[model samples]
Target: MNYFSHNPLNRFSEIRPDTAKMGELWRHEQARVLVVSNNLSLLQAEAREAAFLQQQEAVALANQAEVRVYLGSEGEVPYFALGFAGLPPALLPEAYELHDLRQVALQLPQEQSALLAYARGMVHWNLRHLYCPDCGSLTYSTAAGHVRQCSSEACNKHHFPRTDTAIIVLISEGDACLLGRQKVWQPGMYAVIAGFLEPGETLEQAVAREAEEETGVSLQSIAYHSSQPWPFPSSIMVGFQAVAVNRELQVNYDEMEDARWFTREQIVAGLQNGTLRMPPQFSISFRLIRDWFNQTGAYKLEELVSA
Candidate 1:
């Protein structure tokens, strides 16, 4: 499974509308809260695990939270997320430290990482949509932070959480796959072609378009591979495998620093000699490359990189 896709919570949408029941669950003995400040997750300083506070310990901090979200439940234990513009006064610096989710995701347990990703996405949406787009009025969180309603009696617009969809594809022709690197990325690191899905476009269309625009590699065929819930500020990545029509490269200087077709042997040599680097193992980009390389049975991508 993808890193953030292993969520076990049963998000009971039916019970969100019942304020009394939601409130009861919030105060339940098994209730736990995850805190977010400035889009960074709170982690225990020593253990590096998500800092899940008991309901009693979090009530004071929750009162000051700008976004309070009920992140569903696992059996009888309800999970919630609290977002603040800055660190709450109740937390001590020595006990907890804020870390970017992307940086620490691999270090944390899979389940905790997934839960934190869920919480981060909800908090990001709420914080960004604090005001109504329909009318210039402040909005208040309702439906357990799943919704924001305009405070204006005239507008009364209801807004839900938003997730941007992106298509990431591995474009291959014969024995090689296409990869590109942005100048801003880590030195020597390259990844698959990816772009946000434009309105009025299908996923396959987006994949083909991104490949052509970024690397000038036209696709002959495109196939769905897999998907991953990427919560680096809320986005779902749709993965695909595409066949390229030609090997000619017309690198879009504005979009990427370099783009090239890499054979399995070339990838192994690059990683071994320290001249090339792949994306983090937790990301869909790495998965796409790993799967492609492993298909040949000549080398295991994981063992090559680790060695």
Candidate 2:
């Protein structure tokens, strides 16, 4: 049920390498562009559109963009992404509203949210990698801006966008599931254990390690749940359901401020009352929790809160 999980449009990854065809599509009148500036996007409420600007609107902000990436196509219409690390206020049309990507992710339609996640990830990658990692030379955008190349004659290396893989798991032991809250999070907010994958470690290893490190709980029978594109700067959140091998709890202060196990009844009560705060409905964390709760026919937060 996460916002960025299912995308309707075809990525057309096969055609991204074709520079000539991409160029032609970019010049097409019906081509759509998503403009991302300073982690915000151009949103038009009237049209229920998410940052997806027309070609003319995109061209108007050409001076503000550092790079434009071809973000594949939907049928015959092409989609492009414009990256703006520093966007000028004047360039933003009064007709459109500027909203943070996080807010957009929750408020926008699922299809639009998915598209924005993809575009924002590509934009962030283009903005951060302006130089070659190998040669220390200025890089130029190529392959419809999907690939960047080193300008140096001695060492011309091609670079592509990268996604960091992170594992988030709901660790359960019989009737209760473990949840942790970071110090920086809201007062009552809690989420499942999550951490980036270390080199030479499998997803199962990551789930076991993160669980133990954060809550001092060992996990058994790790199973994949679902994955979501969390473009909070290009991250693929891999969700999993893992059963805790032990009942003992050891909270790691460095990783989490608080860690505890909540029973299904407690979670339901928390949702009914205001004692707990869940992640946004559009997040994989929410989906993981909801999916786990659904087995017991427990009422969801939306039902409790909306009532």
- Measured over all alpha carbons after superposition, the RMSD of each candidate to the real structure, in angstroms, is 1.3, 1.7
lDDT of 1 by residue, 220-244 (tens): 9999999999878879999999999
Q: Local error of candidate 2 at 171, Å? A: 0.7
Top-scoring candidate (TM-score) = 1
Give per-residue CA lDDT, model 2, range 190-307, as digits (tens): 8899999999999989989999888889877899999989889889999999998878998999888999998878887886778888877788888898788778754765665455
Error of 1 at 72 (Å): 0.5
What is the alpha-carbon lDDT for the whole of candidate 2? 0.83
Whole-model Cα lDDT of every candidate shown, in order: 0.90, 0.83
Ten consecutive residues with minimal summed lDDT in candidate 2?
A: 297-306
What are the clashing pairs of model 2?
none
Measured with C-alpha atoms, the lDDT of residue 280 in candidate 1 is 90
TM-score, one value per model: 0.97, 0.95
